[model samples]
Every structure is written in C-alpha cells, then in structure tokens.
Target chain A: MKKTINIPLGSQHISLLEPVRFKFECENEKIISVDSDVGFVHRGIERACTTKFKFDAIGYVVARVCGLCAITHSLSYTAAVEKLLGGEITKKAKYLRILLLELDRIHSHMLCLSHTCENAGFEAMFMRIMGDRELVMEIQELLTGNRVQFDYINIGGVNRDINSEVAKKIIENLYEVKQRVLGYMDEFTNNWSLSLKFKGIGALSLDDAYMFNAIGPLARASGLNIDVRNEIDYLPFNEVGFAMQTQSEGDINARNIVRLHEILNSILMCENVLSGLPEGAIFTKLKGKPNGEAIVRFEAPRGELMYYVKGNGSAMLERVRIKTPTFASIPVFSHIFVGENYADAPAILASFDPCLSCTAK
Target chain B: MFDLKKYRKKSPWILHYNAGSCNGCDIEILASLSPKYDLERFGVINTGNPKQSDIFLVTGPVTYRSRERLIELYTQMPEPKVVVAVGSCTCTGGVFRDMYNVEDGIDRYIPVDVYIAGCAVSPELIIDGVVKALDILEKKSKEMEKPLKLFKEAISENGVVNRRNVALKVGEVHEEN
Candidate 1:
C-alpha cells in the first residue's frame, strides 16, 4: 500500500489573501503530488464586460478584476481601445501612465514581501514592510485620488494630471521609500532565519521556468529573460529607465530579491518620469468607435497581463478576454509545490503571491 | 474556570474568507491589521481555523463554487459569531451584479450582521465594520448566556400562548413590566 496521505490547503486559509484550494499528497513530510482549484473567485467578469457594460465603462469595470493590479488592467484595456480607434495620445499622458504603473508595482511588491515574511513567522519584518508599504500607498493616493482601485486611465489617455506640488511630494516620498528598500535589501540578504526559510526552499530551475513559459518576477527569479515591459512599446519603458531584474536561485529568497530589485528600478523609473515629463494635455478626445480586435499586454505586479478586446463598431464590446498573470503561472506554481515540505506550504504559497481573483476572473 | 465569553469579546480572533469579490477589500483588511491602521490594537487577530474564530470577515460577492465553503465556514463557527460582508460587491454585488457565476451577495446564503460598502472598502471603513461586529458579537454572547425562563403561561382562549411559541422563546430573557 502507498503510505501517502493528503493535506488540503485554502479555499479559505490564513496564508492566502484570496480563494484557492490545493490538495497535497504527502508521505510523512514531503509532498509528492499537488492539485489546485483556482475558480473560487471567478465572477464572470469577462462575460459581464461584453454584455453588462459598454466599451467606455468597461475600462473601469475591468479594473475590478483585481484591485492590486487595477491600473494595469485598465491601462491594457484602454491601450487596446486606442489601438482599435487609431487614437494617438500625447507623450505626457504616456509618461503619467508609466508613473502610476511603476508606483503601483512598488506598493504591490512591498505587500508581497511583507506577506512572505508574515507566512515565514517573521512577524517583525512583516510589520516593518507593511508599515513602509503605506508610504507608497500615500503617494498613490496623492496621484490617483484613490488608494487601491484608481480609475485614472481612460480610453484616449489618463484622467488625472500631476501638478508641480504633487510632483515635488512624489519625489520626496520616493526618496524615503528608496532608503527603506535599501534597508530591507540588507536584511533580506543577511538575516539568518529568513535565509533558512527562503534559500533552496520551493525552488524551480531555469529549465523548468522556460518549459512552463513563466513570466514576470517568477520567471526573472529563475534566470529566464522574460518581461513584458521590455517587449512592449505601448509605454516608453526604456526611455524612462526600465531594467529587467533576475536571479539564479529560483527559490523563495530569489523571488524576494527579484521583487526588491524591481522595486528599486521602478522607483528610479518613477523619478525619471516626473523629471522628464513632456508638456501636453492628459486626455485626448478620440472621436470614433473601436471596430476591430486588438490585444494589449502590460506588466502587472505579478506578471504579464494581456487584454483581448473585440469591438464591432458599437458601444457594446463583442468580447473582453483578460489573461491575467496568475492564471498563466498556475502550472509553474504547482510544479514548485511538489517535493517541498507540507509545513513550508504557506510560506511558499505566499511567495508565489497567487492572486486567485485574477486567476478566476 | 476562565470566562471564555469575556475573552472572546475582548480579543476576538477573526476568520477572513474570500468568496468572489475583487482583492481590494481583502488588501484593505490586511492594511487595517498592519501598523498604520493596526487593528491588532483592538485585540483582533486573523486566524486560519474557523472553529477558533469569533468574528467572520468575508470579502467577495459569493461566487458559485465558494457558496458551499462560505456556508461550511459559517456553520463550523461556534454560536454567538458575527459575519461582516466587506466591499460593495460582497454587500450587493456592486459591479458584478449580473455576472453569470456570482450569487450577488453573501447574505443570499448566510446571515450577515454588518455590511461594509465600497467598490473596495477603505481600511477605515473595514475597521469600523469590525468594531461594529465586535459589539454585535458581545450582544449575541450575552443572548446565549441568559438563563431559560421555562415558565408556563395561561392557556386562556382570549390570548393563549402555545408550547411551540414558548419553546421558541425558551432561552430568551424577556423584559417584564
């Protein structure tokens, strides 16, 4: 008889922020097989996007897909619509969009780092990261007029423009955030207990990462060169100083390190955007309906978020398919869970930062 | 013997479940527990075990697959528990109202004591809702602790009180004139 027992985690658990269930087949301590159910948070957002809301309103509706990456969702959708309508937004609008997107990434990465610490039993570090995360949130609220779900991006361009006072405030806050991130970098690299919990634990190799087509920080951590920011030209990422951060270990520690470096890079990009902002109007009135199918991909906090919008020269869209990052990385997530200890499951899950809402939506 | 009820009222451990809403309210709830909002100051802790919790904080609009688990968690909790529905979608299905897979709100299946409304409710509102749920939890605990009246009233034809009615009010402490 096979002496394996099954342990189920989540759908509703302390470690997970959303609803996702995993059944792990374990022999004593090591997990040998894994199965996951990620449909608990699926609310038919795709179906509703076509039937319930019009094209203009769908920008905000899709933002509800995942609050942590709301800006990315709306930005991709708006970019797709602009592509369809043949509208050319101003350079200033493009820069502002990148600014908000990078700021969102900073706060989101902080949330993931803090959550990883909390799951690994480092309560103090968890509190410290979370407390510092508020600084990014403060800047976000200042720029977008909302903390979590900012419907700042519109069809032609962005909704809000930054004034000099707000710009000054952003630069000051980013400086403070940079200092804090440097301290965290030192701690994450040096702390003995954190290293023990993260290093060589729940690791995925470079081959496995490539085979699974892993994207975002998960791919970057495994030493795979895949970042939508580098590939896409919808946003001027290169001009505003976007760099791809990667690591070789591909473990929880490597993932954290990748996220921290990305945070620093994003902060640099935000500073660059504020200093080199072009002079133009934020919003442009595009006078036409989107009449073709267009696919737009942008980097969400987790990975590459793709939006496929089909329009038939009308107000109501034909189809709005959102391929969220978490949905694509499920295979990679399950692959990493196998051969890991059942007790380290929560920490591993937190490290992946699985957004079931994005997966299910 | 230690007073479990008093301890529960003072330091209510919370069980958070995401049925189907966007993650806005979920993150806000996490933010409230963090240092800035610091809901832990109120003796509230987010726990994984349903049985060990007194206050249940649920986010999402209650999707099809999550309905069973939502009820399972609600039933597994001990008596005198309070359920707080966080977010506009969880309250009344906000933007996802007509979505095919959603069941509108959690109240459709489970009873809700407090509802925090917002596209994604802010941390301040979530803290208020949890504090409000604490009061409701204390009331329910008191209601559970009261002694049974059990006395039989007159069965006069004018206004007779039946056994069924008396059984319904068995443990309730009615106010006397």
Candidate 2:
C-alpha cells in the first residue's frame, strides 16, 4: 500500500497563536517533511524605528513589537545605540536593567514552562504553573508602571528607579517566589506523565541544533554554550555570580528542565543585583548624535538577541537590523518538527516559545 | 442537571490567539498562570491546538490580515467552544482602535462570549473571565441550539451547502429574530 498525508497550516494556524505557516507531510500522524512562511504581521518595525520614530521613542515601540520578548528588543536596541554614541549606562542603571531583564526572564520562562504542561496534556500542572507566574507580573507592574512594554530603559539609563522600600518588597517577593517555584519542580521535573510526554520529544541533536545555528535556550538545551550575557560580558551581569543551564539530550523535557532550573538562578541573580545595587543617577544625558555603526547583543529571555545600528550624526538612525533569537531558530524549528507526531507539533513549537511578532519585525 | 458547579470545578483548556495589538494583555494573560495569582487551581489551561481547547482566549484587536484566519481557526475548533476576549485590545481595539488596519475588536469578526477588561487585563480579571467563560460553556453544552451564525451569506452566494466564513464560523450566527 502507498499513501500520502498533507497537513497545511497557515501563518494563522490554530496551533500558532501568531501568524506563521507550516505544511507538514505526515506518515501515520508523524510529520515527515515540513515547510513554512512568515511575515504575516511584519509591521516594518525596523523601518519605522530608523526613519519615523525618534531614537528615544523607538525603544518603547521596539518593546511593543512582541510583548513576550519586548525587553530583549528594547535592551538590545539600547545597547547598540549606546555603543554608537559611545555612552555607557551607569553601573547602577546596568544593574537595574538586569533586575528588570531577569524579572522578564522569570515571567517568560514560567509561561513557556506552563505552556509545556498544556502541550503535554498536563492541564492541571499548566494551571499550577500559571498561578505561580502572577507574582512576577505583579512585580513588573509595580517596578516599571507597565506590565508588557515597560519602556523603562532609555538610550542611557532607565526611566524608573527602585527605592529601598520597593527593593525590599521585591527581595521578599523573590525569596517567597523562589520557595514557591522550587516547590513545584518535582511536579514539573519528576512527574512521569510530563517526563513521558516531554522526554525524547522534539529531539534537536547537537549537530542539528548547531548546523541550524540555533541560539539561546534552543541551543543551550542542545548543550551549546552561547549565552550573550556571558559572551559580551556586560558589567555587574558578568561580575554577578551566575551560570548557564544546559542539557545534553536537547529534547523537550530537557528544554523544560533547563528553563526551570535557570529560573532559580535568575531569581538569585536578581536578588543579588538588587541587594548590592549602587545608588547613582539613573541616567546620563547623551551629548552628541550617533555617528557610526555598532552592534550590541543581550541575552533576552529567549537567547542571544543582537541589534545592529547605523547612524549618520543625526537624530534619525540610518538603519536598524534586529536578529532575534526566534529568527535565528527558524531552521531549528523546521529541523526539529520533522518526525514528531502531528499532535506534538504545537508542543515542540511552544517549547521554543517562538515569538512571531519579534521575528516579523 | 449536569451540574455547572461541578463543571466549574473542572475548568477546560484554553487556546490563546493574538489577532493584533500591543502585547500588554498577552503578557499579563501569561502572568495569570505564573506563581502569584495562579489560575491553575481553577483548572484553566492554555492549549496550543483548537482540537483540545474548550475556550478561545484572544487578545488584541483583529486586523484585516488576521480576520479571515481567526475565523478559519474558529471554524476548525470542535463545538462547545467559548470565545473570551481577554484584553482592552481584543474587547474594544484599545489604543489601536483608531488604526485603519484594525477590525476594532475580535467581536467584529467573531462571536465573543465573554470579555475580560484591562488596558492589559490583570491576572485576577483573567481568572474571573475564565470562570465566566466556563459558566457560559456549561450552559452552552447543555443546550441543543445550533451555534450563532454571524454572517448572512457567504460572499460568493453560490448554490452550495456552505454559507459560513470558515469552520468555526460555520453555524455561529443567529437568524434575524
């Protein structure tokens, strides 16, 4: 007997919350070949940033492109623009950014982790994880005055500064959150149901992950050492005691565990940064216009987020190019989706936390 | 009576969809699942596929580009489905209401059974909205009425059995009462 199975999904497929198309050739419900097309919501964010939006205002808009990964966009853009202007954010501000950025990491990982639950048929566990994620979002609102598009970081420094009282509250919250989050790890880590669902699922062999040049968690999960925070060695961040989490298998379960473990590390890093935060001017006014090309990389919640900025000594940036982790991981997404059950497609995709808005921009 | 109280105890899985908007609601929606508010105790889950989902939690105002696709996905979902508009953007188009690109709200394109209000909604409200959606779903599952039909006629108006926009919208409108 001979047969053919075609599963055509749109940039607007049910599994994909955002716009991205994938057509899978399946054999007995297992995906055999896969293809995709993006750009459904490509708003020309870079074009608007370089041409229309003011340099300072662009940060807010960049962050808005994808709420899930906004911090990566804003921070990477700031790093690139700051480099072009030969500006360095105060050590205090750098530390603060890390705090906000890591808070972002905590919330994002919680989301991906919880979604993993839903994907694996552990609906109860998904709800449990989501319940715990609220503290992080509440902290974000309290600190930045906004939840998603924080608009905290500017060209030089952050818009908001944390006071000792707020800092204390954050610390208390982090400690409590740490205990609470850790409490759930056994369910996430040891539960046989989740382990069965995720273990060995969506295996991106080290060679395949590297061949596709995957970055961030996708790469890290594959046992690749490529965290941009460590790569560029940003101040305080580099000094702060932290380590990257990775897994050798590069399967879905490994990705989940790596993220779950990394969240603990992220919490400690935030606590340390806040505890020893130096008091100083939150921002330094930049004097001259941006005049040259510069590249900046920041470790976003996803992975290594890179921004390229070209300036012409004017208020307007000449060109802005963002190489988001999701964009870098497209080849990897396609590569891993093959041979997986059609049902597992959504789980594998969500495992990467593919932010289409970030990629489209 | 298929006790709604019992049904409420077992909240169904939800699938999140972003038609288009600023991501304020999207993030907060995700936050409801995190450690603090923890909607999981209520049994609400975010599913990636429409097949397994009992409710559709959407954020952002629908855009022209996303209108058809959203409807198509709605059609593909198995019945006994509830649509929850979970943000100001999805509810009323929010700040993007003025944009030429937006459809104003997901309700403009699809039937929204429940609304969770927020500039980006708070996690509390997200939980509340999910509970409301479950009630609606419970009441719905007990009824034998066909789904609401939003569109009067398919654009082509061909002599075909189908007059719906997409799979989800197939019988999702009420004939003029």
Candidate 3:
C-alpha cells in the first residue's frame, strides 16, 4: 500500500527542538521525500552584521548566531579580523583557543549524544550522559565565565587567562568526564537495540560526503579525512598531534562512533594543550585599523565553520559573511535520508546535530 | 483504577516546542535537564516525539505562520496533556510583541497549564515550574471521573443565571441563538 502520507512537523512542532518547518512525504511510515523550509526565524543576522554593527562588536554579535556553537563562530570571526589586522597572537593564546574549542566539541557532542539517545527511547542513557555532560559545562563556566557561549576569545587574544587555580579544576573535571563518558560509551555501544537502530541506517558513502563537502566528524566518519583542525595551520592544533577518526560504514552508527572518538580526541587535545600551556601575552595592542578582507575556518561542534570579514579601516566592518556547518549539512541531508524509514529520520538528522540558528545565521 | 501517583512519577516527559523566539529559551530549557540542575532525579526527560511526551514546553510567542501548526501539534498530542509556556516570549510575547508576524502568546492559540516567566527563563525556575505542573497533573488525574458533572453542578450552584445571560449574549452576537 504505497499511499501518500503527509507529515508536516515544525513551524511549531513540539519535538523539533528548533524553530523550523518540515514537510515529510511518507509512504507507509517510510519517508519518501523531505522538504525543509527555513528562514521563518531569520532575523537578518548577516544584514544586521554589516549595517548596524562595528567590527569590534561583531565578534559578540556573531557569537550570538548560534548559542551552541557560539565559541566557534566568535573564534572564526575574530580570526578573520585578526588576519586583516596582521597582529600576531601569542602561542599560549592559540593553545588556549584550541583547548577551549575542544572543550566546546566535548560539550556539543554530549548534547547530541543525549538527544540521539532520547530519540532512540533510551531515556536512562540520555539522562546519564547529560549528568556527565554538566562537568564540561562547569569547566567552561570555571574558565570562560559562561556555561554555553564563552565570550573569552576576543580580537587578538583571549579575554580570560587560564590561571593555576582554574587549570587544576579543569584538569580534574576532564578526567572525571572521560571516566563517566567511557561508561556511557559502553552502554550506548553494547545495547543491542541502539546498535541495531543506528547501524547501516542513513548510510552516506565517502564519495557523497566529499561531493557535498561534508567536514568534521560527519565527513571523517564516512572515511573522508577532511578535519580543519589537522589540515589548517590557523592554530597550533597540529603541535598537540590531534588524530582524526574515520569509519567506512558511513551510517548513523558510524557518525555516532566518529563523534564518540572525536570527543575522546578532544579530551586528549585539551589535556595536551593544557599540559603544554605556553607563557606569553594573551592580548596584543593593535595600533591602526584593519584595511583588508580575510577568511578563516574553525571546526565547530558540528563541522567546519567558515567566516569572511572585510574591514574598511574604520570601526565599522565593510562586510561579514558566515558559512556554518549546518548550512553545508543541508545538501547532504537530502542525500542521506532518501531511502531511510521515517522512524530513523529524527535520529539520523539529530546525529549531525543540526543547529538551525547556526545554519540560518 | 490506575495508580495516579505511580504513573505521574514514572512518565514526566517533556517535548520542547519553539514557536519563534531567540535561542536563549532553548538553551536554558536543555540546561535544566543537564547535570547542573539534575532534573532527571524528578523523572523528567525530554523526548523528540510528542506521541511519547506528557508535557509540552512551548517557548517563543506564537507567530502568524506558526498558529496553524501550533494548533495542529496541540491536537496531535494525546489526552492528559500539559502545556507549559516557558519564557516571557511564550507567555506574553516578551520583546517580540510588536513584531508583525508574532501573536501575543502561545495561550491565544492553545491552552497553557503553567507559565514560567523570564526574559529567557533560568533552568532552576524551569525545574520549579515543572514541579508545579506535576502538582496540577496530579490533581487533574483524580478529578477526571466527574469533570463535566462537577463543572455543571458548580456553575448551577454559583450564579447560573449570570453565566447563562453571558452565554446567551455571546450566542446572540455570533447569530448562534
């Protein structure tokens, strides 16, 4: 019975989490086609950036683009502006930035993992992960003053320096988090229902992953080795020797595995960066104004987030453009969800941790 | 008869719906579930499917485009439903009250059981509001047997004539009389 079943979720859907519209064309509980309509909550964020904001204030403005990936957005925006200014940040600042970014990864992955577990009917798993996840938030609050959006990274350097007092807590917190997270991984992987539901569903091959320019763990999970952290020299990530994990399955389980592996790697990177924390000036005084255009990339919680900024020697920026990971993931979503059942759709979409604010902004 | 306390204690699932607000409410709502607040101790969890959720945590002021969808989602939810308006945005439109696309609040479209107020609403307050809702849910479950009869008797005992006059006036105005 291949009859048409129209399922329109969002625009005000209870379970959507984000404010977006989705029209699903299902045939006997199997989603045949999916149409997503964004821009309902678009506040002209990019336009607001160029017209109403100055270059210095845009760091904070862009940071508000996505609450979850605010650190990534702010860092990318500041990096672009810093490049235009041609001022050099200290090695310590770079390491600190990378450390904060990895912390963000840990926070974001835990969020996604919790959400996915909830969607998969593993309420206990979700709650347990969220419990352990608070350690990362506490560590973030300890270091950056804010739990989610750390406004620490500014134009040339970081706002808050990591002192020995906070550093010890952060180190201890990371160890506790890693231990708790290992238990979570054991439950998530060993559970037959979770493994069966996630494995081989929403299978996206490496060719398609690369064709659609999938970056971060989403791309790496499908055997497409394209992590900006390893590939780019924007920061001193390579100095700590961060390893990228990949899987050939390219399914929902593969994505989960990639995120899990990445979170582990992120913890390691943070540990290494914190251990080798250099001593120098966290901030440098910029005498003149920025006069050129620059583009910068950073691996956000989702994937590679790219930012472009052009300053016209004035306090106001001439232009500011942001390409978030979710924006890139949109093209890949259609390809991955083509033949999957409707039940698997939410988990698959959630595996990518689609942040609509990040995409729209 | 089902044990109301046992069921209420076991199934306190919430499904978060963003009508149209800043992401402040969304992050705060998720924060309550995370370890800092430790909401799971109360057996409260967030589910992605409304079919499985007992409470609907509606955020943001309902927009013009979102009204139809809001009603649709409201109807989709099964009985014994509790809709909690979390944040000033959902309760009274917050700062987005003047926007052309926005309705005043989600209550204008669907019924709301409790209102959790704040510019964005903190996780601690959200937990308090949920606790209050659980109290309401507990009361409602006990009174479900004679809800209509009890309402009718109370209306008759407490000035039925005035209520009838008001209803007649509204009916006459709408040409339903």
Candidate 4:
C-alpha cells in the first residue's frame, strides 16, 4: 500500500488566478514533495516575438505577456531596444514611465494581497482590497487611455503626455489611496486572520531564499537585499524616494506586510514624479534600427523581469527572449511548499503571487 | 413546486476558465465581481465547479494543451449555459494569433454566444457582456423548458413500431400554430 498520496491543484482551481498545475505528494497532513507545471498558459510568445512581429512592434506584443505588470514588460523591451539604438529619451518621458511602473506595482501588489486574503478565506477583505485597488486603476486610466493593459511605453519614450489638469486628478486620487493604505496598514497589522494566521504558515528562511536565488518581494520578505530597482541605472528610481521594503520572517504574513509597505513606497514615488513634472517632450524619434543585442532588467510587480532583444540591423530581429519573475523563482516556490501542510497550500501559493501567464509565456 | 428554470436566472453562477490568457482580462473579471463594479448584484457568483455554473466566462486564446480541457469543461457543464468569450485573444486570438501553440480562438473549440472585445476587457464591458449573456441564458432556458408535442399518431411499418410524427423535437415551432 502506498503511504504517500498525491494531490493536484489547478490547471483550473478556484483559488488559483491562472492555469498552473501543482502536484503535491502528501503524507498524513504534510506535503512531502512537489511537482509544478507552469506551461498551461504558454502561447509560444518567444517564438512569435522573433518570427512574426518586428522589433518595434514587439514592445506592444510583449506587454501582453502578463496583464498585471504590463508597463514593466513593455518598458523592459523598450529599454533593451533603446540600449541597442543608443538613444536617450527626455527626462519627462522617463518620469512618466516610472510613474506608470509604480502605479502598476501598487495595483498589482493590491491584487496579490487581495488574492492572498481570498485564499485564506477572508472574502470580505478580498472585496475591500479589490475595491480600493480601483483608485489606482482610476489614475492609470487618467495617465493612459486603458485601465489594465496600458500600452504607454514605446521604444523611444512613453506614448502619452501628462497635462496639469490630469496630473491634479491623479495626485488627488493617490492621496486618497495613501490614506486608505494607511488604514489597511493598521488593519493588516492588528487583524488576527489577515496577518496573525499567516505567520509561520509557509516560511522560507533568509538563507534558503538566497540559496534558491529568490527575487522581488519573495526574497525581500526573507531579509534579502536584492531589488532590481536599486541596481538598474536606466531608470532614476533612487531619485524619486524609492526605498526597499523588507521583512525578516519570510512567511506569508511577512510577504503581506512587505507588499503593503511597497505599495506605500510606490504611491510616494508616483507622487514625487507627478509633483516634479520635468519639462521635456514625451516622445523622441530615434533613427537607425537596433543592430546588436541588448539585455535589460526591471523590477516588475512580482519580481525581476529580464528582456533580451537581438536585432540584425533590420526591422525584424534575430531573437527576442523574456525571463519573467515567476519563471526565475519557481525553484524557491517548489522548495517552500514541501514540509508544509496540504491544507495551507493555497495560502502559501497565493503569498508567492505566482503569475502563471508570465511563466508560461 | 418551484420552477427551477424561472429562479435559475435570478442567481447565475459563473465558472471562469483561463484557456491560455495573460492575466489582464481575468483580473478585470475579478474586478467586476468586487464591490466597485458589484457584478454580484446580478446574483452572479464565481464558482469552481462546472456542473453548478450557468455562465462559462472564458479568457485567453485556446492553447493546444488547454483545448481538450476546454471541451471537457464545456461538456461537463449542465444545460442552458452561456459561454462568454472575454477579450480579443479569446475572441479571435488577438495578439497571440498565428503563434505556434495557440489556436485561432475559443470558438474553434466551444461555441461562444457573447463576445466581449478589448485587449483586456474592462469591468464595464464585462458587465455589459454578462447582461447580454443573461438574456441568452434565459432564452436558452425557455427553449429547453418547451414541452415535446406529437404531430401525428404512431405508425407501425414492417413490424417496426415507431412513431415518426411523435418525434417532433422539443422547442421546435410548428408552421400553423
């Protein structure tokens, strides 16, 4: 008789946001081993990027990889292309790009936190967080035409320019969002179900996070100082009051707390960008096609998003490769699942904020 | 006795499946369910089981691996169901079209009654789509509930007793009603 039993969670589970299958081998209550399949959403995007679309259009094409961090996808691809083309965009465009990126981060983090709450069976809190997330979405719409997939970033610079009236509205919304976030801060810390229950439920220590090469909030929660925003010089992240938020616990609760703090930080950064309002044109026409390969990295809502664009002095590029955050951190995700109870699987998985579309794409 | 078909439209549970989409439209669907959009006011609940669901909300282009599962889910669902294809990718394989692994659209696998067009469908558009789906769902239920009527008496031919006229299909309209 087999003592260990295998249980599968999603190609389509209620708790999961996307279609990624995870098979857990359990003994009694503890998960002994884990096998994950993140290819359910794979549309062969990498192949299409190289073969079908041109280098310029690939920016918009790549943004469709994951909707949560659409800005980061297009921004990363654009940054890579910009490097190859060797053109400098205006200060205003850079500021606008960061503005959208931070706003995307705020909402994406909110979505993750709400999903985590939902997985923990706190449906009311899920509704609450999701409702508040619309504030950020409102700002996103003000900046770009669309709400979710903001095709804001282009190869040279951003697509839209901000006016004073729109900027005023965005600032007002951000302030309201900030106050609400502060309220959430109090609630998340004081609440029993949201933070306390998540404590020690799915823990990954600092050493393990470093060993497994974890990135983004997952690693940051484990007390690791690895943020692509801090490293990259392409964007002026440091100048806009961007600070790294970290927690030593490396559990679901800590990850939640880290995200909350990061949302506040992102709100601050967006505010700073809007207030500063650099004077320059939003778009620049940089001539000459990308001749050589360029690699660029950006901190997406989930984690490190890397884009490699190789062009051969033509409209169509030789290759376009993307390494999404969830794909890079799968090792850490699988490792953390073992030695945890099967019942807490959904909560643990939600805490990681696994974006399967990004991974499979 | 309660009429199930009558009360069914009052609270229609939705089963949302990601056939192979980017998370954009999926999040928008979730957003519509949230308090801001308040899709639940229509008595719509996002459910996991296919059997209990009335509306099948599918996002993303149907990938090769997800095709079988899509068909299986479609078959598993009970009758009087509405399939709403959300986003352009699910409708006509928008951005992911002509990709190696992706199918043209979900309609290739399962029939879509309502198609919501957007790169990532907004909460407003999703609401509109769901409302359209409700109308279709009600129409389907009425069609399903129609009684079977015999046009003529049964006839025995060559020792095979079969009522050819009695085989008037349910919901089929007669010319001289």
**Tens-digit per-residue lDDT, A129-218, candidate 4:** 999999989988988999999988897888888899989998899899899889888888888766655988889899999899999999
Candidate 3 lDDT over residue span A1-361, tens digit each: 6688888766554346787777789888778888987765544567767676778877876776676777888889888888888888888889989988889889889888888877766777777888788888888888987675567888888998889989999899999988887776676667798898787888888889889988777788889988787768889787886887888888878888788888888898988998888889898876567788898888887888888888889887788888888888887887777778887777877787888867655
Candidate 1 residue pairs in backbone clash: B21-B60
- TM-score for every candidate vs. truth? 0.95, 0.79, 0.81, 0.95
**Regarding TM-score, does 2 or 3 come out ahead?**
3
Query: Which tens-of-lDDT digit does each residue in B59-170 have in candidate 4?
Result: 9999988888889999999998999999999999999999999998999878889999998899999999999999999999999888755464578889997865665554
Q: Candidate order by DockQ, highest to lowest?
A: 4, 1, 3, 2
State candidate 2's TM-score.
0.79
- Cα lDDT tens digits, model 2, A242-331, are 787888999988888788888999898998897788878999998788889988888888877888888888888888888878888888
| Cα deviation of B54, candidate 3, in Å | 9.0
User: Is 2 or 4 the stronger prediction by lDDT?
Assistant: 4
Kindly list the per-residue Cα lDDT of model 2 for residues B1-177, writing each as its tens digit: 787445643978878877775556776766666667667777887667777778888877776766787887798787788999987768886645554556778877788899877765777888888888888888887663545545454455465566565433334533331
Ranking by lDDT: 4, 1, 3, 2
* Docking level of model 4: medium
Off by over 4 Å in 1: B151-177
Q: When only chain A is evaluated, what TM-score does every model earn? A: 0.99, 0.96, 0.96, 0.98
Candidate 4 pairs with clashing backbones: none
Name every residue pair that clashes in candidate 3: none
Off by over 4 Å in 4: B151-177
DockQ for each model: 0.75, 0.23, 0.25, 0.78
- For the record, the alpha-carbon RMSD of candidate 3 to the native fold, in angstroms, is 6.0
